[model samples]
Target: MADHAAARTTRSMTVPLVAFVAGAVVAVLLGVLGRVHDPTLSGTTDLGFRTVIEMKVVLATVIGALVVLQLLSALWLYGHLGRRPPSWLGTAHRVSGGLALLLTVFVGYSCLWALGLEVGTLPHGEPVPLRAVVHGVLGCAVFGAVVVKIVAVRARRAPGWFLPVAGGLLFTLLLVVVLTSAAWYVAARGWPGPAGY
Candidate 1:
């Protein structure tokens, strides 16, 4: 019985551990690639915005809201907040999560395709802004974390505690991403529509 229990425990950990390694490798490779590649500057088709940055900002903002909804819904679904989750709550959680992931991919692609990694000083020799550096690191980390979370979530036999932890990590990473990028842009530029539009 003890032997069986030990084997089960080991098996349970195998998937998550593999996932962690994969995530780490992906993050490193992406950062390396971003450093080597020259940005297109033209950006992945701006989707209808005047510029890629504008489109990226808008998509990121929407994804931020969806992420917020995902966190709340997950909490509610797990009975971490309030009463029992409604029947439709599961659907809402899944939909919001899917949408957030989808939009995140778009913003990430735009960043990589157009801007690449944030490094070096400006033309005037001013250092790259600290927020940009932070945002760039977190942006790379996001995809890795998301992969781990998704893998953990799908692993039915994994430890019960892993899903929540993975979700929370992803949540925190995304919140910082939004704050440093979209929120920072809006804060610095005083909202896109007010002046730009």
Candidate 2:
């Protein structure tokens, strides 16, 4: 019994560690590509509004924070799935969930700003309609899932599988939103340019 429990714990930790490493590697590659290609991409800047560099910095920071929080959430959830949840696991789960929610909200707001859809004018700027809407909706969905998780936690009735389910769903939604927005941006204004700019 002791050996089995140890094996389960190890397996749980391994899964999240693998996921975190994979996500980090992909994000690094994307950042490198963006840096290499952003300068050469025409119309990367939103004229008469925020500078491109500022926007890039803001987006990069938000995205990086979100990714890190997601990894942390995954790790917490993995621990929750172990044979015995740690004493502080519930608190850790709540913290990670809150952070994830905040990150999703920031991503939605930033996406709107980047697409020039906010309630302000950047001269000659037009919103990327479908892409912006999709991104915003997906972000909201993730936020909603987080809200549900919070409510469950508060009620002290959260199911054992709830955390993992919520995490997986949010991750999937984020991936779809990013990928689709990228495709739309590429189709509209060629590759390696500011996506949804």
Best by TM-score: 1
lDDT (Cα) of model 2: 0.49
lDDT of 2 by residue, 94-181 (tens): 6755665565555444443444222222237965456555554554454454444444334333345545664665567656665555
The candidate 1 region of ten consecutive residues with least summed lDDT is: 188-197
Quality of model 1 by C-alpha lDDT: 0.85
All-Cα superposition RMSD per candidate = 1.9, 14.6
In candidate 2, how many clashes are counted? 0
lDDT of each: 0.85, 0.49
User: What's the lDDT for residue 131 in model 2?
Assistant: 53
Candidate 1: tens digits of C-alpha lDDT, residues 1-197: 99999999999998888888898888887788777788896637877677788777888889889988998899899889979999999988988898899888888878877878877775489998888888888898999998999998799988988888889888999999999988999888855562246
Q: What is the lDDT, from 0 to 100, of the residue 98 in candidate 1?
A: 87
- In candidate 1, position 182 carries an lDDT of 86
Clashing pairs in 2: none
Clashes of each: 0, 0
